[model samples]
Target: MVIAIGFEGSANKIGIGIIRDGEVLANVRKTYITPPGSGFLPKETAEHHRNQVLGLIREALDVSKIYPNEIDVVCYTKGPGMAPPLLAVAIVARTIAQLWNKPILGVNHCIGHIEMGRLITGAQNPTVLYVSGGNTQVIAYSNKRYRIFGETIDIAIGNCLDRFARVIKISNDPSPGYNIEQLAKKGKKYYTLPYAVKGMDVSFSGILSEIGRKALPQKATKKRKLDQEDVNELPSHEDLCYSLQETIFAMLVEITERAMAHCGSNEVLIVGGVGCNERLQEMMGIMCEERGAKLFATDERFCIDNGIMIAHAGYEMFRTGTRMKWNDATITQRFRTDEVEINWEVGKV
Candidate 1:
């Protein structure tokens, strides 16, 4: 019966959410979108969070119909995100916790996605594919940690898409990745790009570099063909988007299947911002079907960075005797998934 309010601003998005036990009472979010051909920077993103967080918190409280005294705890993302934005949101969370006289818990950004995915989809002990702007990982529960079986060796999948959007001046209104996904839907041709996967690890820098060349004007790109194939001029941006999605998603599916096989798990759960793409879900669903397994997932509401996830993950830790003092609550820019101990029940979660 514990009530928790979570704050999240790990990247361009800022969100406030309130939950009672496992039921979501309020979930609200706002994004700090930059102009076309540009991505959000850490300082500006932090400023946006500082400006919007209090208002969003008020909105969450209003929607939840809960008094400040009723809140059992305040939760915020601790690390593995941009520094400035994470600090801004963490400060707000700590401030609110102090004012409310409640316990403050610092939750891992990646585990927030995994715990929220489990809560929303009701898929216990499934292999997790966490794809976000800042992270790309294939993980599963083993020995009480969300063990990383495979991850990006260089740039993350979402970061790769975001940078590519800047090349073609794609809209960043909803998101660069979302716009790219929409354009990919109308593509009718396939252009080969670099594929980099080694054992269980994958890399996106090569793929982004390869496709970026094709997306540019002929004069701007070097006169070179990848894989000894003809460097054909791209027909349209739509085709470029389509090919990019197919190539990267295939790499993801391949590694995810390998992890699934290694773990002997029949379920695959997709979590994070990139997980919202319908094409990725469709591809992963196909892979699961071929393996005679189930695929658990959610739409943008749960998949995208949101506060409910932070709160949910925080509660999971707080109830298990985890708490952070205000002075000791620190935000990090590079927290790994395997670093956190999963104290909550695994299959039962």
Candidate 2:
């Protein structure tokens, strides 16, 4: 019977959601789109969030049909995200908390994604493969902590995909990664790229560099003068996209399976921006089927960064008597996945 409002602006998107208990009342969100071949910068992203925050908050409450006084607490993403964007959301959250006279809790962005996935997909104690632009990790719940089993030693999977998308000059209207996934479906040839999986951890920097330098055509003029051998060596943008996805996704699947084996868990839950990819889901599903396990995933609604996840996770923490003072509701750029204590793990199912 607790209603909470959550503010999420840890990246290019700004979202505000209202939730009652485990039910979503409203989830409003908007992404700051950049031109093709460009990524959204922190300063510009923060400005976009600040401009959209108040309107989104009002819309969320209006759509929820819940009054401000009825809301039990306000929650905002505290860290593991872009500082400017995160701080923009935090300032508004703190101001509203003070005005509304409600408690505020700063949520870890990664846990918000995980908790929301469990709530939506109903997967209890599943091995979580969290993939996003800024972070990548295979995690499991142990001893009241979302213990991280493996992670990216360098750049994240989503970052790799996004950078590749930029190299291919894909549109950023919807999302670079989304456009890359679309192009990948049309790929016919599979040019083998460097696969860098070191034990349970993965690395993407080398493969990304390799693709940009040799496997793909750099200039159109150079492409025209290519000999048969050179032409054969260079793959189409489609094939490059496909190879990149397959190689990276395979790396992710391997690590996720390793984590599952280590934990002896039969369920695999995929959550985060990159988790919205249908191909990745299909791949993970195949792996899960081979292992006689279940694959728990969600569509873009729950997979991409959104306000509902923040609100739902806030509710979980709030139910467990979690509280944050106004002064403590600060943002951090490097919050780790295993830092937060999972006190609300009593009845996970």
Candidate 3:
């Protein structure tokens, strides 16, 4: 039985998890919440991770009832994330591995999400819909790599939603997306927004720009303050939120279905931070039902970024004889999913 300790701080959340075999023994995370109308800065987020990561790691070890010497390997997310935050976590991970004298593995953030989703859902070779603040893509495993079948041309869907939330100054306590989803539930009208899909890819910048024009006053763009009367002059916030969710989620579902048909897969696995949105899951479920396919998703626990995923995927890599030398444990800011060689999946029918 392999025991792995994983660290993840690729973005605003800092997580420490311990896993035994395929089951998670402990998974803990702490997020840095910025005030309303502001987004998390990389420097500040990295500092937050540095400050809280050690405590989180200790807490995870205590919760799992495992000794540091019992850990077989250490894993950390290496890429496709904010540089500062990734570096902060990578430094900690390398230090721990050196101190414990354990093998260290660097994992791709995107592939970690995919592997964890498959492990949790028991979905065998399903088309993957990975949506997060930094990424949005429809992927399928082919030729020993997760190939991108569809992706966003501009900003990711989560970024679009978060920026829109900033326009209205929503709280970032739990999450901007979650707050938008709750507000969307109160919407009675559906305002039309721009929908852009070319072939299998989708675009959200245009949709965001169009929504801003309708939702904000002409002068509100320069200064993000709006009086109650000014707010009434524009479309209802709930309506805008509702319409945004419906429009973008429809695009996501359409692309995912296209990938399913192309790959001849009857199962769809959703992962990443935005995958926790109930509306997205509901839309994907409806689409899968129409096509006689299955939909697999996890709750917020695994849906959002966590260290367990890094541990799980890293363990798979370790089992396949994949290891990163101490000097080669550098992080990549633009690591593509297909760049990693997935040796573990070889010879599987």
- lDDT of candidates 1 onward, in order: 0.92, 0.90, 0.92
What is the overall TM-score of model 2 with all chains considered together?
Answer: 0.95
Task: Pick the winner on TM-score between candidates 2 and 3.
Answer: 3
Predicted candidate 2 versus true structure: per-residue lDDT over 145-247, tens digit per residue: 8999999999988899889888878898799999899989999888778888898999999999988875555544643875677677666888888888999
- Weakest ten-residue segment in model 3 by summed lDDT: 340-349
**Sort by lDDT, top down from the best:** 3, 1, 2
Model 3 lDDT per residue over 141-228, tens place: 8888899999999999989999999988999989999999999999989998888999999999999999988877786645477778
* Candidate 2 vs candidate 3, lDDT winner: 3
Model 2 spans with C-alpha error above 4 angstroms: 215-234, 346-349
Among all candidates shown, the one with the greatest TM-score:
3
Ranking according to TM-score, highest score first: 3, 1, 2
Across 1-349, the per-residue lDDT of candidate 1 in tens digits comes to 8888899989999999899889999999999999999999999999999999989998999999999999999999998899999999999988898888998988899999999999999998999999999899999998888999999999999999999999989899899999999999999999998888999999999898888778765554365534322335445899999999999999999999999999999999999999999999999999999999999999999999999999899888988888776677889788899999988898933
Residue 277 of model 1 has an lDDT of 93
- Steric clashes per prediction: 0, 0, 0
Once model 2 is optimally superposed onto the true structure by TM-score, how far is the C-alpha of residue 123 displaced, in angstroms? 0.2
